[model samples]
Target: MWSYITSIFGYFFKLQEDEGREKLLIEELIDLKLELEREEFHNQNIENKVQESSQQSECFQRTGFVTHCGESYILIDGSFYFDTSACSFNLNVNDKILYLGYNNSNEELVIVRILQNEGIGWENEDDSEEQRFDVINHIIVGIVDCREDRNVFIQGGDLKFNLDDVQGTFIPIAGDWLEMQCSIQKNDEKLTDINMTQVLQVTHFRPLRTKIKSGTVTEWSGKVGIIDNQIYFDSSTFIETFIPQVGAKIKYLRLIFNAMGLPQPKIGTVEEFQGQERPIILITTVRSTESLIQQDIKYTLGFVNSPKRLNVAITRAQISMILFCNPHLLSTDSLWNEVIMNAVNNNRYMGCYFPIEEK
Candidate 1:
């Protein structure tokens, strides 16, 4: 009876010498599914061939944390890989470094420092942390809230700490992923706040730099003492930017404007302004409470809310920065709130009935 059952099973599964019955069944099922589907649609107009690269010449410095330090290559921001065979600095992972490099055709960074020893933690530190720990344990915590130069509230597991002694060099913002050696005390009778003595590591899960097209054009005109300067506009304000739209037509008007001898500011998106700096920077924040497009707020406001983008935008100005934004909209972000508050404290804020004090 066992032999009869074996023959019946063998008839159904017809396995080859090299293949198993389950593998054959899976292949047959996949073939059936593929047969049911129609051919993928491809547009002939859109070339399928890989195109040769074209990226603008960049001459700007970028700041990024060393996410990885390999034997031959150093990875910055988890994406930018640089050959560090010639690097003089003994770099390590998590070291915040300023690198001046340009994007290659393959989108790799070619690092050659224009500025020397511009890494973070290069400044002098005088403040000392005083935390007397009764017990210590390695744990992970969720950042509930954070204030620069103040205590942080974190909650996760049994380890709850109002961390006042976070390392001054490493600060984690709200919603940041934090792992640290926690200084805690557990009462046999009760539970209390777990004191975090020192923050071991801070990892920000913020979005990477979006490569959305910034509509900027740079033109060069051979002239003595007078050169054509291109100005890049922020993406959030790009739609409402009148200067960039007006600046595009300035190429034709360069000769006309130069004959009149005016300071012509050509306009493009901020990505286009990467390697260039100007004497004046005019930024507009177009988002407002009155009018809002229902979309990914992170993506929409990414251009303005980013530290790197802000650093680029602000530092490009050699002397002055003129900002135009609805404070009501700008205050929606915590980072922007601090910026607006700073402006308010300094009396630099110029807006009608904004919730500056409330923020």
Candidate 2:
């Protein structure tokens, strides 16, 4: 009888334990259902916000010539300036293009796509007649005037030529002096029109030089001397320690080469120089800021962390290549670190003494 009583108490204890487990399981199921509902509510809110934002933004398409193409913005029709950071293709001045644009919630103009680019070139597809023309090389000086219609006019004395008549990749702003080589069209040995075939030089200031003999100088005052009433010379005229204050290195190089009457080297982006080989190539990796390095690595901005782009950029030179970059920033990536190590092992690495600041 005692054993039976003990067994009954044991059975009752087991039943209570099973009931406790079931209650705990039901509570856990309720908590899980609540979490799922919360997650679904959060997703629905995000979808609603996205739909509303899409409705608020306005999108449109337009056709116009690019009047000004800057580093981050492109001016179309001489009025609207759109952000070009998202554009895949490079834009140039006076390019007839069709683009898709939209205004964001902040009312900022954004460029979505570049549909077409009919660049300014002297080629007629409809004209099939082979007209023979002589190539007469002559230099002419003029002042540039950019018009609202995306037309660049060069006016000097009584001469004026349209933008289509000029041939060069350089686009000058208004009031700048342009020295170009052109061919005056001749019909039957008589000049019919003055048309510019090529642009050789462009400058902002007019070049003036005066020559004087030493014997022609009559009087001298302090550091200034007047010679033959035509020219004056001072201590500043002779450069003791010449240092050019230039904002851009490439432009300064171009100016130096043009002054010496030498052929200018081609300067273009990596994408533009693809499939083209050069004897000497200089690559400028413009990212040097410590703060931006992390962002660049995360997004693969530029050649950093991008193996294919880095390979293409480094292999373009057949003879020699000079790469300018910050080793401290680029060494964060394995690929770039390998390149740096290779250069150091080859004894070809040259480092700057001072810190490189972001430009």
Candidate 3:
């Protein structure tokens, strides 16, 4: 009888000990989670500081017309004298240039040839079409109406291209632009015995997409609250939700609505924000398709594949950049995978698929 009683006591004691250990483990896990969150916040703050400092160090690109030039310096718009020491070529008065250099101690611009210029009466219309033809940047306007194959037309200044042989990663649309290298070549067949000029192959097509993809619609209040310095929607759907009716006025801001009635923040797609910067940016990577991996891959994968677009998205943030995305989905791509790895290494990443070190 004593042995039986002792055995029961021992079992109860073991049960109590097991329960105590389990409680201790739960407490430890909670502590670890809180610590990780703090670490992630700290790491992200550090990255923001580094980015801000780096941007402050570099000079922003500027465009102004040259008013005059001395033997040593080029005067821009009769106000600023930019150092011409590094200019391999000479600049005359009234010349327009894109200058990419920093201001010196005297607050004068020291420039190099990051320039693009178009002067008054630069081209003569009387000149032969072939003579006027040269390679340059251009924007797609619309498709030309023809009984033959539908050909897209592009225009830049006096230059125009009937892009019959157009091919690109994305479909050609009106307002899409590209920086191309082109030339005018005479066609063998003549129009009424007159030699006809045609635009040659567009050697380079800059990947530009202005059309916003469809984004997941969040609560109305959530969208409204997020309106700040700069907001980037991964799609047009999200944009529509916030700015529902065109020209419909609602009061939360001191802002007036445009004809389109969009918010004050610079709202655009990831692709449209190329070569653009903002003090703060929020990127919402929306995934709403049923086949999340396959269908969304067309759009989401595009973001991951193009290094240029990624570069623009990341570097645009001068102060801070917040990415609203499912890391697991993004991790499938190589570029995004690298980002994940970097975030993990820096202790900035948090997700279910990857292991987080408690230490």
Candidate 4:
């Protein structure tokens, strides 16, 4: 009897110990789970804060234009843009920098004060320009369509491209009304059919000389593919494009419209159609496309003097719609819907005769 009672007690004690061990293990598991959840919560909070801060980031953060002339860096993106002198820095290709030292200096993008990401990899901006023609720095080759009222062109080069005729700014129109001071030149002097001289001045706009493909012809649809890049004829040599990619102090800005609203243009003056093919409503007096690019800033507004001059200039916009408003006036209609038909019914002609009128 005594042995049986002792064995029963031992068994009971062993069972209690096992239960205690299991309870302890369960508590430990619960504690570990709580700790894991805490870590997750903390991480989520940090992420939320980061996202909030990023959302608050400014949309129109202005930066200075950068140019490297020898070892000296030139800040040339502003109207009164100049860097006290050519300041020297161990400038690299990519740096998310700001210029604060030159305040009230009339420079949009000024200094190297607040480097984003605390000076980490900043090469992301190099891939900004999407145009294949961007890398080709063209020189002012020749001037064309030189007459009394509109005396512009580089010289000798092809201006068969009606500045008022190109689907873009110049050829389709007279000019973009902007100017440039470019440094691109060709190696062959004999290739001097295009005469790019005059230091730098306001000139008509035209598209850069593109090596059109050999067996390609522009479809009525106005689409060109990569295979068609082999053979190129100067349509300007033939017809002409108004978007001047060559010779000028700078290229006009290709304005991208954010929405449906019209923005103003910087045409030196406004006028009626010069008997050209384009619509007359927004006809901007001929200007340089290069200079347009220089003037684009957030909230920048001006009127396009002559909507016809906007032929190539308006087409330069790659992404958004660029509304070329009147730099001087904001009339009800920025579009030339009336002129397209009026030329046909009424005897008023711009740059060239209207086919609609003939019909």
Candidate 5:
């Protein structure tokens, strides 16, 4: 009986040891869970701080106009010149822009983006007047209708304007595509009227027989001409090519035509040609280097990577659109790749390889 009692005491001691071990394990698990919670809270705080910093940076953006554009620098508001090394796109004088920099330091200024080209704003001569009128300029495209002597009109998509209200030297011709630069008058922030300042271009309407053509950069000679009522592209022709190295693309085209003794045709940037249609449009994708592929994709600045810009550039033509680009470089972007594939499927793609294959 005494031996039986000693065995029972030994069993009790073993039970107590097991309970102690379980308690210690529970405490350790609680501590680990608390540490995990603290870590998550710390990470969330860091993210919040980063977001706050980004918001503060955006708040510092300022508005200004480019008064002069040089090779290495651009003058803003005719007061300060900023370095252009960081700029991704070409800048021209009279471009209203938004910028980021310290108001007190001209050296720290950088242009962020262009607001508009050739912006015009006028207020009353009296500085203390509470009322104001704002004039904004726009480039518009529409189809002309000369059905009635007093009701001559131009209609484009959903917008229509009476030609009688517009002041320009253009004599309205029926079935012509009209592109005009006009001014919108706004009084107290309300749109009052639109007036055509100049007739930029006019193209006669033709029956839609669309043809797409693409060529390699090596084969681009900028030669364009018309034969038998159809436009032709030849690399060895005497007519000057429209190459936009700086300033406006239309300006370059005009200069080339003047040099070749041909009347200048209407040519403008994709941005300028929005809401406009033409019988023929030629687009040049200027980015060709392999080294710039990743950089251009990251920034979405040029034709190779900017899908929206490519869409705008290709869709502006109603009859024929000629595209000149390096096929290898354009294939790096998905949208551009689709464009090449579409052309290839239609048997419209024309490619040429470099004399020496690039490494």
Candidate 6:
């Protein structure tokens, strides 16, 4: 009985193989019959004709319109469409792809793979953060608050910071940090009862240039200025500020005081400012504020560069000049006492401080 079963199984397997071959033959015969009837080729040795399906594994490259793409599949639109076996790309919703196909079935366009460093072209650099420079240009909406020496907090966005200050629909290109040494007319914002108004002319363009402090700190009593490495004020107020290097510039600045919620704080010491040599912008804050008090001392700061560091501190108001920011400037080195020092325990200034001084 076992022998009989084995013979039956063997017979069935051979039959199935014969059937598969027979089907292929039948299809070929039908196609050939039609071709013969149509007189396409001479006395055709159809059986001897090489079957190219076996050689379909030969790889080939082609360019075609991207008709469709699924999770891991790509259908190239062409005269003869093929399954993209293995490829890569940074394709958007409708990005065309160049496919490389090996065997007929083992082919594809792997987008994730192409987005990798080795796969993509020079565009791979956009993925790195070190070489990225993101510059944003916006109009001066308003000033939120200020620091002691010359750090002013500002508020404004949604507007483009363009060279021509033109408004229109445009695409946002990514970058690392902004590099600016130009000034625009500051009109409405008003800051008064503030010393170091000479700090009106701001100058900061690079990161290392942000750390700046004045020669000294003076009091609100008399016009403030420094002498002999000691802070001296009118009513006799003073703070020991960093004398800075011989050619000290606005490269090293320190914050004395600043209101919360406001990004760029005003009232700071210009530790360094390489004024005469190059233009380096210093971005202290990138925030906005809703609450402010004008009934008392308040100041705002911004960059100045009409030709070189033009003042944009107070746009439409009259203010007293107290501090000057120049990396290579000649100011007293004794008025470092006025640097405001208020630690922000909270980030949000909603119901925080209602500037009751304004009421």
Q: Which ten residues in a row have the lowest lDDT in candidate 2?
A: 200-209
- lDDT (Cα) of model 5: 0.49
lDDT: the better of candidates 2 and 5: 2
Q: lDDT per prediction?
A: 0.45, 0.53, 0.47, 0.32, 0.49, 0.28
Candidate 4 achieves a global lDDT of 0.32
**Which of candidates 1 and 6 reaches a greater lDDT?**
1
lDDT by residue for model 1 over 59-165, one digit each (tens)?
Answer: 34556667777887878767877766434567776666766554445766555431233355422233212222222121223444444345454542122233342
What C-alpha RMSD separates each model from the true structure? 28.6, 28.9, 23.0, 29.6, 26.6, 33.7
TM-score of each: 0.28, 0.30, 0.27, 0.19, 0.28, 0.16
lDDT of 1: 0.45
**Candidate 4 displacement at residue 171 in angstroms:** 64
Q: Model 3 reaches what TM-score against the true structure?
A: 0.27
Candidate 4 regions exceeding 4 Å error are 58-359
lDDT of 3 by residue, 1-359 (tens): 99999999999999999999999999999999998797667544543443343332333346667777788787775677665543444577666565544443476664434345545322222321111111212122222122223444443222233355333333455655443322222222321111111222332233422322122223233223112211112223234445533233333221211101233477778877777889899887665333556654466564645667677777889897777677766666678677667778886765466744322
For candidate 4, which ten residues in a row score worst on lDDT? 253-262
lDDT of candidate model 2 versus the reference? 0.53
Off by over 4 Å in 6: 1-156, 163-175, 186-251, 255-359
Index of the highest-TM-score prediction: 2
The model with the greater lDDT, 1 or 4, is 1
TM-score (C-alpha, index-matched) for candidate 1: 0.28
In the range 1-359, model 2's lDDT, one tens digit per residue, is 99999999999998999999999999999999998797667544543443343433334455667888888888877787766644555788877776655554588665545656767522233322223333222334455655435345554222334455434434567766654433322233422123332221111122211111122443355455433321223433324443222121111223223322334577766877778899999998888888887677688776677887788888899999988998877766678777777777777889854223321
Best by lDDT: 2
